[model samples]
Target chain A: MEAFLKYFDLLELSQEAGIEDVRKNYDYLKNLYSGDSIEIAALNTDFSPELRQEYLARLDDAHEKLTQLLENKKPAVAQNTVRMDDELCDWIANIACFSGAALKSIRERMVVDLKDMFTTTRIQLQYLEDIENEVFESFRAEVYLRSYLVEYTRFLSLDTPRVLADYLPRYRAWAASRTTPAGMPHL
Target chain B: MIWAIGGGKGGTGKSFITSSMGTYLAQKGRKTILLDADLGGANLHTFFGLTRPRYSLTDFFDKKVALQDISVQSGIANLDLITGSIGSLDSESINHGQKQKLFRHIRALDADHIIIDLGAGTHINTLDTFLLADRMIVVTAPEVTALENMYHFIKSAYFRKLKFIFKAYDLTTSIQETWKNRATYDIHNLKDLIIHLKQSSDRVRDIFDREMSGFVVHIVLNQVRTPRDILVGENLKSVCMNFLGLPVVYAGYARFDEAVLKNINSKEPFMLSNRLSPVATEIKALAENIIAGTHISVRKDVANGSLS
Candidate 1:
């Protein structure tokens, strides 16, 4: 852990920083020292070229090590959840049709949470829940429902066009069932 | 708080910034004292349109007069001026004892802020006085010569500080000897020297890590003409941190305005006359940054050749 933290100290970042922060700071510091601007020119006598090269090498090493460390540490839960099983894939492939309940079953088998999906996709939590529960009335229009489904399927790493092909027909059938036949639905 | 403003090269607006910032602080109701510590070639009094005060640092040194007595009213509210004695005392003439005494009395002076305007060049006296400040500020212009000298000044100050630490540790001779034969140890810069010393023992490393944490210098870029020029401050900060392992705060920058020179010539207090001006706003922001122990955030847009 001490060795791991030294990289963060070199980049002047905290241990809690994400990979993006590490990359940004590394790029900034690298660009800064690599330049031959007047600031560096002034140090010509003292900060020899060899010394600067050595410093740059250290920066490269730190950046590489920090990137690897953070990448390995970042998605421990996500990594475990993303391991696809052959049985699950076969089950998904053999399904006769796609439905909200099928999508919910796949997500639960992978231990993916609705809140995590909302956080990553930035789709509203209520809308995501509505999509999973097949609350078709909550959607304002067919286009909204289609776009939301596409986004939701993409978030789950599902085949988007195929899922849409299977899901849209079901939604259309439900819509047709809800419509009245020639003013017979006044009740 | 005590603020020392110095840049190695002259004519980079060190005194101008000192006077303007002092005036600004005083106008903001802080009892400020402006010390013209440029022992040779002092002219900060002229910025305020004051005639050479009868008693200067000369009295304080030769006559043993108190610093409070040497201070004369700056013709502005809540501001006092201690004019430097021209040609009477150069950096060389002031002994170590005298420098220590001056530093002691400077700290003892009662004021909300004592802004010391130091002379150009990395004189030991100047460096020591600059190190004495609660806030150490370096002012520089955008030109190459100014930037180069600014780096020299900061490097000298950092070395002087390291020497001070080494002296406290009773390893002064060790540093001098190592620096004398630095090539043998493959020490190229101060950072390398520090690393080499740390390898000598754990005690030196601990002392260095503890003592060096407080040695932060604030940079103020003056006379910036273009949008590109403002990025110099950020660049300087980066170089200092990366190359010297020194933490530098880019306090802020002031744009180049001919009116600044005109104000100095006319002896008009620029801060008061141009309080609403952009330069004044920049100076005020920098002063507040220094007071608040904060720095400005500069973003570089390489594609646009501009900064925001």
Candidate 2:
């Protein structure tokens, strides 16, 4: 974000000066930074003729626009500039001071992505919650039913014939735990 | 819209219902993908009678193959299967990176409804996948073990999702922190806590209301032994509403029929073996009601390429 703001400042400075001043300033800055090495490989890189020309044209257009804005070449002004209301002026000032167009664009994109991420995640969370709810409820029911089974064991023990193994501590533990038994034990 | 089928406990028939639903949708001419997301025990393929999946989720995760390549075209028209790599690589082993990768593939897939058969339990991976789906169908039996697991699953998932949403709006407060502390059972009951949150952040209440409104937690009870088992569904609905302040609509109860067992033994969905079987019929009816209730139009999504 800071890097984007720095580039934006340079762009704004270019727009404020005349095209000639912008061109000269660009060269001055470029030379002052000549201590930095230029990549010969970048200039020598192969690109299709049409692509190269189009890229160059874009660079030139960007430079030209910045110079014109910097020069403040006043003619018939476009409606892009207006006497904004106090509220609007304050809003725009806040936005300009606190934001860069490039950064704003990035933030907009990020907001959309975040919204999508959260939306999908929220649904997943609901599913998890449902599973938890169901599982806990099942455990509750198991607790309830297993106790009932214990009561039933005592009920049947008094009245009729019943297998003691069915009422064994291991069976009770297994019933209480509700954990699935392991696959058929290795031979 | 994607609907994840999961139960808190393993072996409560999450894959069974998911695969059967996939089969039913295929028979109805809707393109469907049954994602075997159970990285632990990816046996959904076995339920389909496929001895060996040509490409499993393991291949995709390992970068040995693309997701599309791993997607096996089922014999049933318009149905696709993404086999899970269970025994070889357990579902619990996948970290956040792997889980995100799996979800990305699931979101990009073309299907009318991507029914994710989530791995059992409420680990971060499973919960994350569950949260990513558009809707969720929690399946459980009448047994107590299944109900308890399901309850905890819902509570954790809801808390995690709410925390994410509140944090998104930059409205983190003490209430949010209190909610995360699962120790306090009464946090779900405290109106004062919500009022405190709302006072600190106005949007908190709105976010909570919106999530509570759009959220659909459908409960489906499988393997009912008696009519009394049916009350378990109602009991769950009441608990959700009373305790968590979330609306839970009962999806339906599937009877414990020998046919479900037969399908398992035969390596076929009961719906395929006998569509008219009591349990299969119940499942089909439940599926229909769910689709209708959710207002998911297979035709509309197909037309828009949202579902293909």
Candidate 3:
């Protein structure tokens, strides 16, 4: 993985790099570290907790070096750098690989969460649509019924012919109650 | 499974066959939903002596009731009828969207068998509804014109089904370029075209094979005038094989019986009035054949993880 990065000059760690460049460099480092870790873990199934802790610490140290490079524009402690220590380098490489594993897990979880959110929102929308349709149907039926009632009332309130007569006790009570009457009284 | 009875020409006995089968199924104690999917010219109610349908397909569409609630029990007992718009339905009234609504409602209807009596035509709406069924029964008389119309109807349906299957596999553009071209439609044998399509996609091959193997392109020859009319069913079966290379089932024939005409004129179901008539007897026999055929398919479906 590191060899793959070496082929791409754009991926190299730099002093004047932006956050995106730092992120990209960190990703490459993490990928190389995690790949080595997976290989070591596959071989040494009975690895000790101490060995694991040592490898994890080395990984954290590499990330810190990248972070420091981004923040202060200088690499971490050059005088203290154990350039001849092959074991330390291997441990650091394993840590970066482990970071890649962690990033992969984080991305998978984000995808699942996004899917769940979309499904939940879709169900909510369908529920709202069903309620809306029900409301609309009720409003339409109500309007029809109201119009029917108005027409029925008008039909009932129409005056009767003179022969059949609209006159009844209620009509006479209304006539007496009125201030004036224009028509001739019927016996 | 639902069967949507439809084709391009009117007065082709879609209503007659649908009602006869529904009645026969009811008598045999199989619960059937005789759905009226004909939105434009719904007359299934009149065939069953219903002057006014209290509840209709419109009620389901308008959301006044669930599809189940609107199903009126036919006096035949086990069969239920859901009429399409009896009075207010116009051709322009039922749009594409409403037809989809009607289809969805038809699917949700609970019954042992569902038979949809669709309106006549190769109208886009009619074609879509016909293809939506689990099985398609193309009803044609022994007349020259009816046979010609049925031929074109089957071709259109076959093309549409192929088009749909190709679209699903994301091979629509390729299929359209290959087949929709002037040279391809001119080919007499659809089987040859299917063979060509099989070379391109296995999914297309499976769809074609499935349609051919499961159902036998069941044909019902109505209004058979003479003994020679019986030969029409056999002739149609041969044409289907030679042209489409599909096994065709001559389910049975409904002869030109004066009784059927009388019942139709009187606005009564033939099965209700005269079950002993030749046409009624033929229909009952046809219904039995259909039930037997469907049961076999149902067993296969159960084996394939499909259950009621």
Candidate 4:
């Protein structure tokens, strides 16, 4: 832990800082030392070129090490999630009907695990699986399902209003098909 | 709190910032005193639209005038000014005993805050007054000349502080001897000198580390014209920490505004006339940051040149 903290110190961040914080500070420090700004030029008398190179090298090492450390510490399922390509993003945007299977397929194509979704959204794991499977009976009421869907879509950085507009109707259709209306379950 | 504003170069807005901050503090209901300690060229009174005062620091030093007696009201409520003598008692002439006495009297003044506007250059008198402040602030522009002088000033102040520590311990000769043969000791910079001294004895190491930790200098970037210019403060802080091993607080920055020059030329208190201007807002933020012992946090996007 002490050794790990030294990396945070190098980036001028606290140990509890998030991965975003680490990346931001890393980019900042890297840009600062790599360039020949007046600030660096003014210190030429004290900081030689060789010394600056060493400092930059140390910064790179610290950034690389911290990224790996933070990556490993993330919930197992999120470790493999890659940046969304434009094509994938376009496809997700063109998703006219957000069915449970479609949402599951989108998650799969993005390499996002259900457990990671659960970890981030903090929705019950069983309920998340149920929602992905379109198990309408599993949800006690429409409100719970709608709220969970909102959280899940937001976590995935999708357009919440559009996703809700497409997906909630299907759940309502399922509720109407049942003999009894989907009302709040008794506590 | 006593805040001393000095950068090693002239015409970088030191007096402007000093007078502006003093005005802001006084307007905020703090009993603030503005002491123009730029003895060689004291014109902070001009920033407040005031003519030359009847008394100045010359009265305090040449004759035995109390600092309070010499402090003339700045026409603005809750703010007072102590103008430095023009062409009298150049910084070089003020001996160590006089400097000590001035510092003692400054600390004894009854006010919420005393902001001192120091003259340019790395003169020992200027540095000692800067070091005397609870908050030592260095102001600089984006230009290379201003930056170079700022670095020189900060380095001189750091060395002075180190020498003071050694002198307190009666080890001035030891430090002088080591510095005299710096090549042999591999003391290429302040940090290197510190390392060499720390290896000498545990007592010296403790005193050095303790003093270094307490010796923090705040940086204020003036006349910032672009987002890129804002990053200069953070850049200075980074270099000071990494190379000089000095703790620097990037207090904040004031953007370049033509209105500022207009205000100064007209001898109007810029803060009073342009209270809602961007520069005034920045100065207020900087003053608050200084008082809170916090600094402006440069966003990473700004550092990466992503935010214009």
Candidate 5:
């Protein structure tokens, strides 16, 4: 599933499509290649039946994937974002900064443990530091950032997509402060 | 190999699967012939876009035509179809002896593969023909009603098989009466029947053990929509195995495609017209599996493609 996420672009599906949208797209593409499919007749005059079957199978395979995206399918409402409460965010910071417990003593230690638990999950030290510091600026690509936060928070045993949902608005507000009211591009 | 396609439920696409499978086998260079076993409601020829032929099973019966004479060419190379009787009460009301004679002739067909599409309903004619086939497939759509009807179909086929097995016993008549008389002792389903057989004489139990060990049934799920629907065949196989002790093959599934309707209305063969569709791919895979006799998940010997 993690590897197949790369196919979102290939399937013409947004990284953010809900389960229902995903299902609808799958059906639409499936019908487009069916025996009496008008789409094929109209679009590809020299369409190879073998190629059509292969593409349809790949589309089915892509749609068959659930991954963690389906978990985040429902875009969280403002009140629905996971609440960290000042204390947990402070604790995430404090654990990386000053916790006396051996396992939670450092962000690197926590990351190592999380990496071991989720063997396939890829994480960089910079991303780990940004997550711990609550500095959401560097990871402005909303989709990847939301996905990363969802995983990191889940590893820390947080409320999962809900917490990431809560953090998104804050990130947007912080990003807004750096730009002018005219919405000009700025670092 | 004679493969009988029957599911007690109506509108489960048995004819569609039969026609597609027949076409696929023929395309694979196998000598394949399809029979319309649905006496009263026969329509397998329509899937091949064949509404009428010069000769049909009716002509064989009424005109005293030879069975070979009625084996009409189905257009596809190596494939012939004996068109079904169109609403003939004579075929429907065939006596047991006449039905047996017809089945014997069907079995003698000079083809490598014979796929007979039986009509909906668990009538004795349907069950007997289904049970007589070298291979049997039960088709069901992924709906609660279809699944329920499939269960009933399996049970009926199983009971018919048991009836055949028990006929060998000298005390067959008494055994059947006693087995069915639940008032004397509660025997609930196929499992109970097996348990009842166990308490009988060693010879009766041994005969049953031998015959049933050879019986295998295959299942195909059709018009599946959701991912969960794909598992219905396996789930049905599991239930039958656990409850009835029958070996069921989960051949594969056909995704629901609207083109099925369009093809039907246009009178185009599905696999030929929609060569690249998922339904076509699945049907082809199903044909391969049936040919390989891997439908039995266990290590049972392939029945040599003869259920008899």
Candidate 6:
């Protein structure tokens, strides 16, 4: 739990607050403090100007952080016991190296280089992990993962859907295989 | 939440906005019910492609059917519609007792939202129904007459709310006299009346304060063709805030898409028709803003007046 999760409590919401909740609370708070109407002024007559400004800024920060959380949230995807085909896995492993861009001898140096590039593009470290670890299951839906991959590829100058077109089939096959008795035949 | 959609003028796209908004909210998984409270002109049924509803509110009134029993599937997911029909007993001319009965039945509805598509003009029934809604959206177009009607509707509602609140106290006589004096003097705005009331007893002032605080009016502009049309909503919000002395939220606008006209003709909802269309996108955005309760052009003030 980060320190900012308390902002949810400040807005009288749980940690799992929906987008609607964030919006409603933010709207209400904004109206309550925006200081432009006579009715609300009649209602809250005690708060000084400085106090109102401070409170409004805090609320804006809280609302902004919560919205960012909603945007960056990784959906709860099923991961345990899901396995991928080795042929698809090997292909993904090759793409994971970004067509030899990450194929450098110094592994730590690659992480540092990639981090700077990701920072420039505002892509997350977890997204990079999701792409590199082919054997691991995605903690988000396929659509979101594919879109993130588009941005990820764009950040690395792969800037095309080739990775998505290749990776999604195997991802679907892996997802489908998990539902089978002996984890059905390979794609 | 109960929503009443009405405009002072006719052909300002009340029914179209109602059905589209209902469809949009329903598509978002709300258990939405659209009631054609437009008794005299019960045309909400036509917008959904139905010539007439199999079970209109007539069944509820004449046959004594339950309100729930009269609700029919609107074919939109999670949406049920109660059709209004032109019968011997008119919606516009519903008596006080009948209005009370309908109000009770509407309150008893178990859905997440009851969207009442009110008839045009500010009749007693229309005003009462519009006032009772938890959320009210006044639909208007970009024309002068439409905007004037919207203002008239808000003014009527403002007085209606005062009447309803003052009814509880024995202040009806004084309130009536004050209202009569205002009418005689042509002092139509509530500011002078509110100031006059504050100088009276504390109870009337307290009731006025509480009622004014709770009475939030929302606006949505329909049939917008250009950016100028879209700007009508914000402009209206300013006028209402400054003139009407009531809080107003400009809940965005829907464009005048030709597809929307075709959809109305074909009985296809805008949500299901070309969701990628600009109008559909605006409707969706409208739904988002409504549910989110954001994009309020007028900010609420917390300043206490001399009385408080």
Using DockQ, give the best candidate's number: 4
lDDT of 4 by residue, B220-247 (tens): 9999988988988878877788787888
Backbone clashes under 3 angstroms, per model: 0, 50, 6, 0, 6, 7
| Candidate 2: docking tier | incorrect
Stretches of candidate 4 above 4 Å error? A1-6, A15-22, A73-187, B173-187, B199-201, B303-308
* Candidate 1 chain B lDDT trough over 10 residues, lowest sum: B299-308
Query: Which lDDT tens digits does candidate 3 get at residues A54-86?
Result: 544554555554443233221133432113246
Clash list (residue pairs), candidate 6: A37-B301, A40-B301, A40-B302, A41-B301, A41-B302, A41-B303, A42-B303
What TM-scores do the predictions have?
0.73, 0.56, 0.55, 0.73, 0.58, 0.58
Per-residue alpha-carbon lDDT of candidate 4 for residues A1-187, written as tens digits (9 for 90 to 100): 2355678889988765767888988888888878888888777667687887888888888888777655523324554334789999999988878888888888889888887787766678898888789999886556567667876776676777798888888887988787555643221
Superposed model 1: Cα runs more than 4 Å off: A1-12, A58-187, B173-186, B302-308
lDDT of 1 by residue, B83-155 (tens): 9988888888989899889988999999999999999999889998999988999999888788788888988
User: TM-score of chain A for candidate 2?
Assistant: 0.22
Compared with the true structure, all predictions reach lDDT values of 0.83, 0.60, 0.59, 0.85, 0.69, 0.69
Best-first order by lDDT? 4, 1, 5, 6, 2, 3
Listed per model, the TM-scores of chain A against the true chain A are 0.51, 0.22, 0.21, 0.52, 0.53, 0.38
Q: Tell me the docking grade of candidate 6.
A: incorrect
Task: Candidate 3: list runs displaced more than 4 Å.
Answer: A1-187, B90-97, B180-190, B200-216, B294-308
Better of 2 and 6 by TM-score: 6
Q: Tell me the lDDT of candidate 5.
A: 0.69
Segments of candidate 6 deviating more than 4 angstroms: A1-187, B87-89, B176-188, B199-201, B296-308
Q: State which docking tier applies to candidate 1.
A: incorrect
User: Residue by residue across A19-138, what tens digits does model 2's lDDT show?
Assistant: 565575455333322221111111122223443455345445555555433332222324212233565434433432211232233224333232332242222333223222322333
lDDT of 2 at B40: 82
